[model samples]
Target: MSYVLITGASSGLGKVFAQEYAALGANLILVARSEEKLLTLSAELRDKYNIDVRTLMQDLSLQESAEKVFAFCNREKLTVETLVNNAGFGLSGAFDSMPLEHLEKMIILHNLTLMKLTYLFLPDMKRRNRGSVLNVSSITAFQGIPYNAVYAATKAFILTFSESIREELRHYGIKVCSLCPGLTETAIFDKAGIDPYQTLMPIGPPEPVVRAAINGLEKNKNIIIPGLINKILIHGGRLLPRSLMLKLGIVLGRNKKAFLQNSC
Candidate 1:
């Protein structure tokens, strides 16, 4: 049977995506560092949805991780019909203050690993003339964020890349989507050492964001921005001068510490 392979499938948005696809009767190949969580989720999905769920414990931050996942899929004869590159994290601080290793790992997880996985699986999808790729970016991708510089930049790459490939794959009936969700209720802030309750902005729920992403992909929407406020923020930034947006970003970074801390 065909499967949907999701990286970072152990928790937060990735876990939600796995559950959403499982409910739709799609077999799943779940990848994450937490083998125990993956196993529990896999069993739950199999029991609840009666669809096959395969778990692969892999740390996607390592540059070679994607190759291992590809090899595993090939050896197991798993035909991946959908690929969700959702394994990513954020570092919230002055860029220089953040550990270089942390920054490098973030870059690898968000950009390099995602790119490599897409490159590896896209060929077979093209050959079969059917597939979907959903990449999780952020509203921050629309402009340069101050405190979240590197993270936003990586997401910008994802946004641009997803759009470019969506057009390339259009004639082949392969869907590629960039899911740009604003602050949602997730443990990302805590993981990044930022307290979400301190932020003033409304925190979105993961369910709606996941639903919107799936619905948008089904409708062939290349860019899926979930909330109205997020859409307004992203588009309004686009309308403003780049200098003005940069100034605003800096101001937010300096003045709105709580919101800035959790926004990315």
Candidate 2:
């Protein structure tokens, strides 16, 4: 049977994606670093949905992680019909002040690993002439944010890469979509050290975002921005002057308490 392979399936949007796919009666191959969470979710999904759920406790941030995941799927004879590259995190602070290791891992997880995984799986999809790749980007990809530079850049890459590959693989009947969600109520805010309440922007729930992603991928949309407000922001930002947009992003991206603390 074909499976939907989802990375970062331990929590947040990843967990939601797992549940959504399970509801569709699709078998799942969930990959994440947290073994306990993966096992628990696996059991829950299996019991509730009566679908096969395989869990792989592997961190995508490290080198050779994508290869290992591919190997695992091959060993288990899991045919991945859909690949969701949702394993990513954001780091907020002065780019210079952030730990180099953390920055490296973020880049690897967001760009290199995602790219490698796509490359590894595309051949199989091409052979079958049917598959989908949903890359989880962010609304920040549309513009450069001051403190969240690296994260935004990485997301931008995913968006552009997905668009490019979507066209390239169109003839093969493979769908490649980039999911760009804004300020969703996920653990990313806490992990990135940004308080969502302080941002003053509407924080959307995960369900709609995941729903939009799945729907968009089904329709072969090049990009899927979840919230209406998020869509407006991305589209409106394009009409503004580059300098003005940068200034606005700087103001919006700044963490209030951190800015005040740094000032003092």
TM-score for every candidate vs. truth? 0.94, 0.96
Cα lDDT, all candidates: 0.88, 0.90
Best candidate according to TM-score? 2
Q: lDDT for model 2, on a 0 to 1 scale? A: 0.90
Candidate 2 TM-score, C-alpha based: 0.96
**Model 1 TM-score on a 0 to 1 scale:** 0.94
| Per-residue lDDT of candidate 2, residues 1-264 (tens digit) | 899999999999999999999999999999999999999999999999999999999989999999999999999999999999999987887789889999899999999999999999999999999999999998888888888888889998999999999999999999999999988888987877778788646787899999999999999988898888888888998999987787667545675565455446
Q: In angstroms, what RMSD does candidate 1 have relative to the true structure?
A: 2.8
lDDT tens digits, residue span 127-217, model 1 = 9999999999988788887777898899999999999988999998799999999888887877887655554445778999999999998
How many residue pairs clash in all the candidates, one count each?
Answer: 0, 0
- In model 2, the clashing pairs are none
Give the C-alpha miss distance for residue 145 in model 2, angstroms: 0.8
**Candidate 2: how many backbone clashes?**
0
